[model samples]
Target chain A: MMTIERKPPLGKKVQLMATCLCDAFYDDAAVATVQVLEHLGLTVEFPQAQTCCGQPAFNAGDWAASRRVARHMVRTFKGELPVIVPSSSCAAMVFHGSLLAFEHEPDLPAVEQLARRTWELADFIVHGLGVTTWPGRFDAAIAFHRSCHTRGSNSAEAAATLMRSIPGVNLVEFGEAEQCCGFGGTFSVSFPHISEAMGRLKLQHLRAAQPQVLVGVDTSCLMHLSGLAEKEGQPVKHLHVVQVLRDALKNGGLL
Target chain B: MKFQPIDQFATTLAPEKRQSVYGGTKATHEKRTKLLAAQFAEPDHLRRLAGEIKQHAIENLDTLLPLAEERLKAGGAQVHWAVDAEAARRQVLAILQRRGATRLVKAKTMVSEEIELAPFLESHGIECLETDLGEFIIQIDHDHPSHIVRPIIHKNRREIAVSFEKNGLGAYNDEPEVITRRAREFMRKKYLAADVGMTGANFVVAESGRLVVVTNEGNSRFSLAATKCHIALVGIEKIVPRDRDLALFLNLLARSATAQQLTVYTEFIQGPKAAGQPDGPEEMHVIFVDNGRTEVLASECREILRCIRCGACMNVCPVYRQVSGHAYRSVYPGPVGAVLSPLLAGEHFLDKADLPKASSLCGACNEVCPVNIPISDLLLRLRDKGKREGAPSPGLPPMGPWALLASQPLVWKAALFCGRMLDHVPGALIPVPAFHAWTGCRTLPKWRGGEFRKWLRVRKK
Candidate 1:
């Protein structure tokens, strides 16, 4: 279990890509992401030009719609700055999807170059930038909700490693963390019963963990879980992992 | 009597509650899957074993087939090799003719459906009866199986009662136990009177040339035990190298199929009844049918052969829940069937190309697959193959404009602009059939009068 160390000389300029889910449901997560980046002495820039990485359309057999969205995103984010996304789903969409969509296209060489520069926030902080320090310390039990996009689709160990690094944060393990939260965008509404059923199952696991907060990178999953949690009146709160880190750094303890 | 296509019967029987029950049950299934996942934390090792065994079997199929035939023949069993479904039917009919099998009792077998055995036998004046309870209900109503495991999953109890009444079992109750008992009583006489018992083997151990059939109801045991002559119709792919392989398969088969630790009865038969046997079939025969399986094995689609017929993939599938299995119109349906049906049946049924597209590609099937087939990837490959080969495309509109627009950013932007401007277009100008299926379910989101890329460009400036 590797802990994220908060090293000195943390003041650095970084750009953040507010994932589509964060922008839509949990705008607080975006603010927290920026706050965390800045509190660590890093200047954060928000790229407003972003909309979506076009994953929903791509998964729904609408490859053309996905490509259109992918090209737009690639064109919008073309620069030398390291792009960080709060949500692993969107990050994966950018890192892996862009290359796939453009692999057979005539302009694939350029698209592949753009894809190489993208990163999920945890991966950026832990693997790329090598940041291991937080400004605050909180002594509360928390469980990391490994989103399916982050676990099966992306890499679970990477996110788990980043969380374990934060001090005083007791990360509890639950069953089937790699399974989908059933927030498959259109999948939720299309198959509402199955979607809700899957959501309830996830909620049950979260309750079983008895965590003070449920942390995940994807706000879509958080939103779905939050709705169910609110309905069930569960004590567990859903928050992005970055928010906890940001609170620890700024407040010097749990918020 | 031939088993009729159940799709029509189900549609008329319980059209109203069918969707809700299917949808509700799927939700329950997901919850069950979560619990099952917790109970079995490790990756299903049985799937890996089944995959390895199948791969070994396919590689040595040439040697194993003859070896199996020789062993069966030595044990007083006749072996018939059928090249295709037609030939398979002829061989079975010829055997029935030799034995004068007028009434036949059958255990659940997908191969029998593949060769359309019931109809062929019925047309030739032999009465075919389904012994499995689910198959019996479908048989009484002249319905094709809706799910491979549940058969009548689309039908509720009331609809089943009506079918039972229509078939002269009017005293039957709608409770599951009662209905099962009714089916058993009705089938009991047929099982005794039938001259030949027919079944499909789950796995044929090539080492001892033994056939294994697993079932919960014990109907299969009675079907084979009561009859004077027993005939087993098996696909060549069902052969495994050794006996111990059954332990690995038996572990996963029931659990994956119905979440049971083990099915109630697992019967292994090497040959017909030996001397002084209390009760068993007096004579035994095994028919090994290739029926395009060799072609499938030799082709790039060999992974499809790893299927154990557990039907877990179908139970959790979102697409199968919506359309049920009948829409695919094949003996097999859902993920495995989408790939295998086209290959086994030929390209003429390309109208079923929609079957492959029915999935959301959520990868649930792959997760629960006993053999770990990348069903979504295979389905995509089949779609691409269908398009390239100039299949009929099920009269669906061409995807040329969508494909072209997606490939080029400028063209897509223009299309988005036109779409946004004409957001209120009364669906008349949209001549594309591709959008029809989409719009039928939900309205396309309004484009907000400008493309995101164009907005980004202005903001950057």
Candidate 2:
């Protein structure tokens, strides 16, 4: 039988592990995440000791190497605080992927302990802090893209709830809302033609909605969609959900 | 830098035909979703039960196989065990030779495609005919099935009309009903003149010795009706312990496959013409083919054996929408194919190593599965297996460098400092093929490495 861990209650203090993609291409999303958390009255701690949760290597099937990096993550964020990650894909790698790599190891308990403390940014806001409504009014028409990693979790619902909570935010609907954006990390490079084709289809649906912006919880997906849009010369402003939420809160002076 | 087989096939396909290949599948996908939502208050409950029952049958194959064989034989049918594809071919050839069979009529079966039975029989100077409409088109054109259940999904109606015109099925007509009528008329003589008939069973009941076969076109039934001898090529994994388990599987199977409450024809064959029956075959033979299934069963991917050949995975797959079936270069394709085809290759896994790497691991296949197989998880396992076994891993960058860079903070920080240099370079001049693969059709965000950390530090101070 597999061992199951009980999750602790959400607390005031939380450590942040901004994903490698966020550090490289989406620092604005990370900054927005910290602001949103701080506005919710949570102490956002950034662990400089953390680099990555080893998702790229792990997804590529290098468990031996990924486990070493995953162990570093287990050792670096040594606290009872929840680890809030802006990307749902990165959060899944920590909670779900850590188990897939670290099997029968001595520090598996520590790995499991830290996994329970991980939360996606949108999920953390709606569920962790139980903040259902936001007193912000930055209005814009936007479409939300739910990344594939967030499929079996409540993170998509959480993100949608947070979106609906923003006053004057018109959440537009489009075709094939649940389809993947084809940015499977290395998959984009591995099969660029197919990736571009998939991205083109996604863009067609999002564009049909006539949204001013494309919002999503995962920066990797946003980057892929934004890049494809820019290259196609039909670029739409793509922002993380936290960025939109933070800007709204700042516009309303609720922070 | 190397061409992945799937991407190669997809990129070379005519751009105009892309929508045709995906249009029908997308419609079926939407139909299945709506039907399941309307039919069951909790459709997932049925899917879970079916998976559990299939898994139970797989676990008890040791005892169930013998029971099914004994009951089937006792009911006036012949049961043959084949340890591999070669053994299966030999047994089938022997049976055909003894029966003096010269012409064979076939229904749609992916297993025959797996064993390459049609080509092998034709090579031996026998006329083999496919009676199913989509399959008949594939056979006439000398092409392959693009989807498992919907065989000729890759070709549009215009392509079919052209193939029909070339093969003299009729004049040039691309009407959907006309194409189907032409096939039905063409198959009538083949069924009557053919001395041997072949099919693949969807489920074999151990308790009652009943073989269940379902089809929308009633071709499987027609293939058996006028033939003197009938042969059923069954995968050993296609077994259910009780006859009633068909209720659970049938409910999920039809809805997941084509969004029907039930297929037009569902046949249950206990044995040949029982005691002066008006119309049925005189002889019935069931060849239980074990080609690579036992090998797959012994490994970590045993849950794939629970597949019901619904073709739901292919419909929902993003990669499959672009590449279709032929890209897989195997009988199975799409998300399930990505996991199964490689492991099914066994010792020759290197030959098909690129299949597992073809997917984005989007987990859509698992959601649409009637049997609740975690295909994305299995794809990851196969990728791991492929890497460990030294398969030629293309389309994937070397993870070793990433491991070194991501495992340590000091090294990672230093790399980030250097990454800022990427901001000065244009997207096209990055020189990394992986990054260039991205920029070839998309723009990259300006590098903002360490900006988040520096800001966080200032806020803390």
Candidate 3:
């Protein structure tokens, strides 16, 4: 719940919490997150002691397990460096979810300490670093999957602003903008049909939007959306918001 | 799949039927959102105030409930207290029996459904007819109401026509107007012959002892008009502190439930014709049904009692949109059902234990909630409660192992090393049930675990 420093000169160092999803399936998003921070001249520190943010167990309603796993994150990322997470849900876990999961725990103060310094990648770019416009340019139309957790937070506006800052980037509009893509961690596996039904509906809107790529801050959502698309052999691709930014930076003659 | 978990029951419904549910809810959701935005500079302030009012009434229920009872009694209404569904149904049956009323017209009341009052009365040889159009369709067809506010939301006009035709209302006319007309004509006869009317109270004003009921179709007004005996079965939680609070709750209940600024009929009943009034029942009774509400109020998730039976949470919940109301398989359905159903189950809490896990916890329900019930957090707590209570849960792995692995850095790194092997192995070769469930509909990306850490370590070196 730390107010992200809107007025910049946020200390140049930050810890990259390359969440469980990034650690398992999408390291590139984590890597791009670091590159983006370095491009903004921050010393991106990888806390080697880091593991998962405990959102999976936390969200599953296992508060004890969630707190146990999340406690490790609190212990690992103890320094004052602002923790940057690639996924909005993961960032939310640190800042918001931790507070709830640890609401009554003796270690709540420790949890709050970590929560104070957490920021989603796009939110960090827009507010933490004060990076509104980008020198990078990639000319492509894309539909941004405004993941559900973005609601009630600055992440959605922050992500939209960062995406629009690229000169040639086009953010296509879609219906049901507030809808979730339904990749709710274990929800997809537990309720495959219901989760698929929502994913199908979301993809239908995205396809109707006719974008070249589907971009989102959380790989968890994109994974479900992209996987569903791939299951049906739909040609549209999905990428993390950081990956798209990475592409724009690469297209702008950066190695 | 007859009594399967929500997910399994949902898999049985055709995609189009589910789409119809989503269509109904999404239109409602968008309308309410736009209207709220247009009406208030801060709709949330109104929502917060409403929540606070309900919270105040409930927290002070010891005084409020007593005050409401005395007020209703002072207004010449006989008051009955029922501790459970059976007690409530028994009181209604006893009253009907004493009044020698066999034929009754009933408004759409979720409380009646909660008590299975119609079926129970029918078993006692008293014919209870549903007067509300949607409830009529549900009653004649022997179908359950999928959504509380919109009973037949899961029933299409085509199916309604079939049900109507089979029930001898008409000969297979699916036109919406025609269906309404036929239902109206049939209900007119039932109202004429009915000796008693049963209704649900939307709000019980403790200060005035007034029972408030609203209907879009004016059926409750009709139900009250034609009957000499009237009974109201209300939840203990429905009580509000004062009469003026209705101004806030009525607008919210109407707008949040159906996007109406106000329903067509907002009837304030002051008990049994009230000294030679032109209309209303001559004899009136009010039953305060606890039905596990006090326990809910005592629990950490007491905020759920603030629900005004507005289905906005259902309208905006993606899971509810796809699965529809019946998937939840409770008198209340969707996000509210997911929380309240299990709790309402009381000693049989495990019966509906799966309800809490039914949501994806996307928090859409919380966002659209009129009274600002923290539905998502309640769902989380219910899951925790279920776990603690030893309810039969979904066949997911124990969280302890996952938590332990994630907490230990070396174990997590080694697990990431093993995760790379998943990239090479065919998903089919994996023996995990959860994996099979995942790959059934979606493909997985190749594992690149620990690569970020490796790159970071090298860069530092």
Candidate 4:
């Protein structure tokens, strides 16, 4: 019910930057991404030529390689339609990280163009599409994990708003909810113990909340948290908000 | 001591130490947040002012330092320049030896810590007593301060009680007030008996040549007052342009440091005690220590000088919250330290090179920095600096080949197809070290549904 403007109503046409993580790790969330936009009357175009946002290279301090990879993404998603990303981190990479990587490259303008149009899906749904509530029911206690990239794109509140839209969902706020889940792309691999320790602390807070479902806009965070939970045999379910909302819409407000 | 990899330190030693430090910092961090919210009428405006003041000061140190020196000399205080830690130590040692001052009372100064002054003084038979409560506890316990502002931030009440008892301060309970009183009583004698006092300046005003020291307790004021000769050791970067600029930094300092409207004491000493002054030191000497600061000022990481040493960045850092300050093994720790320790160490930067990689690059440090230092960007610059200087590689999966594979469209699809095929294999059976590290905490979500590229191709047809 928010009255934010969308000059080109995102529903008519859009391109999906189904991040490499979604393509290889959580493709169902990628499908949910397409379905959710289609449900709202948006023509979601998946640029098959898109591969990676080059976040790994960028964060690894390989600016030259990051620029090379980001150039491919920029070249592939060249149309005028808004670039919708399911992952906040990838979306942020396109918007902020890619610009920095491509700052001195000849394709700087194209990268800047992509950066300007990039939108994280939760933010796109809530603000770009201006739909706060949907006919979806999820009868479960839920908590949203705000990833580090959420800060860059300012999507934490929008993601929270999307979760609150589900009619029967019981949203519980927890401590350290805004802290990083230690999935800093290569950070987890480089410093596994510290990364695991961080994830454990997050799990401690999430367990205290005792949510039946843990929701997040980014799979990377949920992936880290769920792995830790599985190791400890905690039966909490982890779902991307897109998948949860998509299921609710498909099942007629009952998920 | 040789350099140990930070990740290795975190894995081996940080787990046990992090929780206690986290608990102590979290309490202070919460208190600081609340106090800043209540006190600052417009915190954002104050932050911008503080940032601009620091930026201007660092950019014009050549003119400002001479101006400050002339004013200080005019006001009857001697000012000395030290180009490095050795020179800074020699200057302080000469001052102490001239006064025959063997016993010294001191306040907490990260600059002094930077120079490793306490041990240096101790080796020269100068019994330097740390009068600040947190510094007192750590000094008596033979431990380096784990935090910049909160010196004993790694210690809990029970640990302090044990330390106080062990140091013969008397049988003490775990109550903080009781331990503080014992420390105060113990430090009072040192302050009175000490021949010279040593403290670090929070800021030095260029216009009036005033050395400002901000403290929660009145330790700094007492240390500066009771002694005959007071030596103020300050980093060259601690200069502010005018006397009135104190109004901007003082507010930002307290708010960012302990989240207070104002610390209990904000003392501005103008060239020691002048003629006809009732109290304060007879002679004041301000030792301006360069100590690689000029080099940092010339580098890409110069904005790091804008830091007021508030320690807010550490208070909010998730990595600092988990690993504590000791894990950094640098004079400074957390985000600021990560950028600073390397840039300041010069040729030996790789000694603490792992510091830059310590962060998750979450930007929490930048978000809370009062001076608006784009610290995360500086951190990335250090990472690039390290790579260029031939520091050890990250020892993780190489991202270069991945980038190459991601750029070509045909190879990208085949790679995606392979990734989808590999998704069916249980993560446990993958036998990849990178996967092993990742799966330790989180289960990999299996790839489900069709690859987006194929779906897009079909839709196009």
Candidate 5:
């Protein structure tokens, strides 16, 4: 993928927090996140010491475990560069969820610092850099799936605005776009039937839009929806919004 | 109460069946909420005032309750104080016994449903009738109310028509208007003939000693006016400081509940018939029920008492939209219920311990709440409290091992390497419990070039 020209006055480097989902399952999203950042004129660094965001443990009522992992994350990404996460759920874990994780830890100041610098990919692009329109064009119609975390953060509007700015992409809207896709980390396994049911409904709504692709800010939702859609032999393709935006920027020949 | 796992409760109704029954109500609720947002010029400011009023009233309940009681007594209405649900029930029975009342007409109130007053009264040989159309239908059909505000929300109009016809009304059509008319005609007779009218107040204004009741149907008016005696069963937390504060609450209640500027009827009952009003209850009784609410006030989740039972939280909740109310297996359901039920019931009530985990911690409930209760944060706190009390979630790997693996890079790398080595083999070939559970619905990604850390490490070198 080719990188676009940089507009000055924005921070130069961002440490990419490739979430456990990106690390283990959706590596393409991790690659696309880096490409997307570089294209936006930001130097991207991968901190190899990072693993999980401690969200799974935090949400599962294991504060000790969450604190242990969150402390490590704070230590690994302890720099001035903004920590950019492709997954809103993981980004939320860093920015918001980690507050609960490190409440009683001695490194609370460092954790607070990490949270202040942490930003979801869409939020960092649209708000941190004030960039809405990017060099991109995808002829395919795209429907967006919003994670519960995005709806809470500023990322909900950011993702939508960024997607709408793609010159040739058709931003298809659907009902229940903001409904949870039921991939609540451990919730998917703890309550598989309910999780799968919610995913099915989300997929059904996405299909109603009849878009060529379903894109979302979080890959966990896509993973859950895609898994359910695949099992039912439903013909639906999933892509991260970052991937869609990055692909179009590369295709625009703006290197 | 017996404890049941959430998945087991969820499986009670198949996902398809639950969706078919619940989907329409969820959509209608979403539309109503949108309309409410559009109509209100400053919803946030209105909510702030309403929340502050409730918080202040609750903080000074000792002063307010006595003032309310004194004013009610001065106005010729009897005010009875009950410390708990049993005492509250006994108070109602005593009133019925003294009046020698055999027939009862009741309107919609979650508090009444919370106390199970109808069944208790029925067992004591009083013929209790539900005057609200939804409640009436559920009563005849021998079913509990599913959704709090909309009691029979799980049933379609066709099912309701069948229930109405089979119970007593002959050969009713499925049209909602016709069913509603038939219910009104049947309930009007009960209202005119019943010895006692039982109602729930939306707000208890201390200065005026009034029980404010709001309803779309005129049944509450009929229940309070058509009978000889009226009894308003109210929770202690429903107090507002003065009659003037009602203007703010009324707007929030209707807008949050049904997206109306105000419900069709908002009646202020200030002591009996006011000394010769031709058409009002001759005797008025206000039973202030504590029912574990003081404990709720003293707990860390004191903000939960700020809930006015508007039910805006349930309407926006994705989990409630999916599973419906009965899945919680409690009088209260959805986000508010998840917080309130376990808190009210105390630690011995293990049945409701799992209720806190029912949500996805999605803040939709919080966003839509008129009183601004941080329901998602409360749920998280409850989950932590539950863990401290030694009730870990059933059927999941303990977090200790994963936390340790996550903190140490080498061990995490080793685990990733082993996962990659196993990934070349089909995912189904793995027999691990967590992996098997995950793969049941979604495919595990095959490890290609190890995890991102290893790939990034090699690139760095």
Candidate 6:
């Protein structure tokens, strides 16, 4: 279980909603999320009953399947402090899809409440706990690929702002930072040719940046890009924005 | 020789058959973008260059227009300024009358289509013939271009063969070369006998008053070279400051369009004919049309004026690939078209509202745009404009209430629970037309009768 730290030291405890992608593919992001919150002098709690965010189904045009998943998520984190999600994709599902998913359900009011409390990991850190500075540093050039769901769909200025705040980091700006990476969930699978083409184009841009690390809020994009990078033997490393920050905080400003 | 309804042409050829051919073209387009993206390894560099060029051009457009007109006039090309489409058509008709041009041969030009020039000319007794093979097919079929680069994208060879048979060319073969031969045979006569030649300028270099026409088939060369009198119609926004700017644009244009090192023919005509030139137009005129261009250029939508008409954005657009261009209901269809059509055509057209929503906001168009137009960003802005104008809703599902509910947690929870319960209902209850459009293609599931919180509570115990 995760414990949430109360903002202003008097607010209600917030719940840490470990995103399904982080929980399954990168448990380290979830663990680091907890560690970062705890380092900020707040209690962090994890609701183990959390499941997939229903994005896969929702994007596939399967509304009914998505609603079932959304209902299960709302029920699991109902009373736990405001739900703090580790993944932007999961956060988007809660913030963007929940109400629509349960518009006609019997417990629509309850579902709406759960959706409102959900905050993306960056939002929780920047807005919820108010942690402006961290005790970590990295001496490397970084290019941030702002995911579409985070930048366009959700207000994702926090992570980039946070990265800029870190010491010894040179953040390079690429053209059209808010564009999609073309890894549209099953889009990569359904339209593999176009998907690979788009991915290669993105990879070309990434290679041009020649960054030691490529940081972003969503791991799904990283996972897809990393696979291609590994195949091409590119030296660029993919890291979740939160993990980079958590590492800095854990190392007491040394990275 | 006249502009025809898009549906009439689309329906003549089976939509399913066209879908398969266009699907292949889309694949080629994607491959081309990837290859070009590789060549332009530093995407940011091109972005910076494109942005800088556009900013400079837009800022000095008034200065550039007159300078271009003067140079064109000195080169023996008469220049005419048009305030709107009607004015543009009138100017074109007047030029035809003064030149005594009864038969006209035309190269591919979107400006002519936008101003309905061919129909007006035909109505006034001039026989207009489209010289480019793709333009010829569309002209004969009386169809609007589906793709800017490939106007006949929605027509398969089999269907084209049928059109040819009706033109008295008797069924020869279903091969592309055979069809090209048939078009060539028909257009050759028109080109040879044409009283005036009309072509669209891809880029108008303000420094020298030169009009550049890029084509794969050399048809533009023939149309202009074979005529006694030549008239080039260009949008005011097509002007660039210098000759050097053409290098970057030409390099990116063909690579983005069809992945070629260069198009087959890049004709730069500074004036109608040089004093010593053996074969060229004796008389030349360039009609600069400012139909809604000044409005778009002066407003926040000015970024769209930078388009080079490479059709790179359309080629890679997924929605365009799925629905094809005819569904867009505009001469320009696809990502660029979505933003451009509504802005240029006016929001009064009911279908104009659908233009913005026709996209999934996928940003592919922005990626491949040689001029670096922020297509997706502009698309969203257009959508916001539509909503503000109370443009009739595209009948999309009532996402407004849902979007509001999703932004708030409490309402979201209640909505989710109710949605879960309704999932169990037998009959379809999708309230929004947009939502119904989605559900109509897929299935809905039944709720498990318990909220996610309830399940969590049980597990905690």
On DockQ, the leading prediction is: 2
Given candidate 3, what's the lDDT at residue A205? 92
**Can you rank all candidates by lDDT, best first?**
2, 3, 4, 5, 6, 1
For candidate 2, the TM-score is: 0.97
| Reference-based lDDT, residue B164, model 5 | 77
Clashing pairs in 4: A227-B441, A227-B442, A227-B443, A228-B441
Which of 3 and 4 is the better model by TM-score?
3
lDDT of 6 by residue, A102-137 (tens): 655788777666666777878677766676555577
Predicted chain B of candidate 6, TM-score versus the true chain B: 0.90
TM-score of each: 0.72, 0.97, 0.96, 0.92, 0.92, 0.68
lDDT score at residue B195, model 6, on the 0-100 scale: 90
Which pairs in model 5 have colliding backbones? none
List RMSD in Å for every model shown.
7.7, 1.8, 2.3, 3.5, 4.2, 11.5
- Better candidate by TM-score, 1 or 6: 1
DockQ of each: 0.10, 0.78, 0.67, 0.51, 0.47, 0.05
Cα miss at A144, model 5 (Å)? 1.5
lDDT of 3 by residue, A1-255 (tens): 232232233577888898888888888888888888888888877878788888888777788999998888888998677888888888888888778878788988888877877888888888777778776787889799889878777788888887888879899999887888988887887788788888888999998999998889889998898888888887458788888788788888874
Model 2: lDDT of residue B373 = 89
Query: Across residues A112-201, which tens digit of lDDT does each residue of candidate 4 receive?
Result: 777777888989888788888877667789888888878745588898887787778888989966677777877778787778888888
Tell me the tens digit of each residue's lDDT in model 5 across A77-190: 977788888988888887777776566677877887777778888988888889888775777888888788875577878988888888888888887776788877777777
Best by lDDT: 2
Tens digits of per-residue lDDT for model 3, B236-300? 99999989999889888888999989999999998888775887789999999998999999998
Ranking by DockQ: 2, 3, 4, 5, 1, 6
How well does candidate 1 reproduce the true complex, by DockQ? Answer: 0.10
Residues B1-461 of candidate 2 have per-residue lDDT tens digits of: 66567887889887655676689789999999999999899988888888898999998899999999999999899999998888898888888999999899998888888889989988998899998898999999999888898888888899999999999989999999999998888889889999999999999999988999999999999999999899999999999999989988888888899989999999999998888799899999999999999898898889999999999999988889888888898989988888888888878888887898888888899889999888887887787777788877666678888888887889998888789888786665676777777778888888888888888878779
